[model samples]
Target: MRELTFENVTVRFGSRRRGTVAVDDVSLRVPAGQVVGLVGESGSGKSTLARAAVGLAPLASGRISPAPHERHVQMVFQDPYSALDPRMSVGESIAEAGRRAVDVAGLLELVGLPGDRAGDRPHLLSGGQRQRVALARALAGDPEVIIADEITSALDVSIQGAVLNVVRELQRRMNLTMLFISHNLAVVRYVSDIVAVMKDGRIVEYGPVDEVLGDPRHEYTRELLAAVPRPAH
Candidate 1:
């Protein structure tokens, strides 16, 4: 069965002075337990599409069918610091997953955070720690799908690896269907089984990661590959 899908989705916003179509007509699907990377430059409707997939963004036209409640879609934002609350300590923030808001020490441990760090606020924790907490909170709902929108962009190289590993493990262990949205090609390639490239608010090219990344068919996709900086071994 299909885990998540967007059919001919269109999102348009008409403000007081102007109107814009953030997400053009887009249709996508991710099978259960597969990770599909939505690769695009900023404003290419990556986040907008991510939100739409999870029913956060109202679809102006077309259809969005989320799986049943037990198989609901979940989102993981890019900025862990911004996504988390400063008023609550890391433990308290994670504890929100509980029905009555009990301690989340076990949750912290699951995300690789020390139990002692539970009392620290977002400001005190490192970029990686905050993200771990975010992961714990998002998983608190026990979602079937997790939308990670450039969640590691704000972290250091070392921290990026840590967060990505956690996501990868969770996907494997839980058989999660995920939409990993990012501007970073390397990161996308690392986590995705398949990739779809978006341009001008539409997916112009898509295929298996090896095929798309190894031999890009689209001009924009080739350009994206060329712009990537490689490290000399």
Candidate 2:
């Protein structure tokens, strides 16, 4: 019964007089062992909502209740270089999140990185490799929920698929409840079990991924799908 629930959540930033509303009274449910995609254009509050799930953003009102088992929820940011320590070895970074003596080799293997890479610094690895290390670090927490914010947006197209595959495999094996935030519709559709579309700090459409993406009812959702780039025959 592990799950994450957001009840009438509102997240505002800055002074009330000129404050900006990032997440506005949005309520959503993410059942355990489910990958919920939060998709929207830039400034649509997708990232804000994901950050709030992990307590990175302050809630102006409402509540976010994490499952009892979910004592630690980790986030994998878009920029691995920034998220990771430039001076620390990959193994040290992972161990830091574990808050205990973690098996760095095993974690590297799990993320498809070679064991020897554990001693390398963040700047030495390729963009894709660094991202994998970031994933391993997030996994080190043994989190009940993982918030991935635009993780693939920084990688090359060819590398994006590989990174995504690792995430999908880990989610299935770990039975992780994931809040995947991205502006790419295709990527969201590929990884999400359920989809929540946000626009201007509100969920404009939500449902099973197939239902929402396949037969979108909301005008904004329809427009989003239509805007996705398609290859010509």
Candidate that scores best on lDDT: 2
Taken over the whole model, the C-alpha lDDT of each candidate is 0.83, 0.90
Q: Write candidate 1's Cα lDDT for 80-176 as tens digits.
A: 7788888988777777765455557777777777778888889998888888888888777667778899999999997799889988987787778
Please list the residue runs of candidate 1 whose C-alpha ends up more than 4 Å from where it truly belongs after superposition.
Answer: 15-18, 67-71, 98-103
**Residue 91 lDDT, candidate 1, scale 0-100:** 77
**Candidate 1 Cα lDDT to native:** 0.83
What TM-score does model 2 achieve against the real structure? 0.96
For model 2, residues 124-162, the per-residue Cα lDDT tens digits are: 999999999999999888788888999999899999999
Weakest lDDT window of 10 consecutive positions for candidate 1: 65-74
- How big is the positional error of residue 154 in model 2, measured in Å on the Cα after superposition? 0.7
lDDT assessment of candidate 2: 0.90
Flag regions of model 2 displaced more than 4 Å: 67-71
Candidate number with greatest TM-score: 2
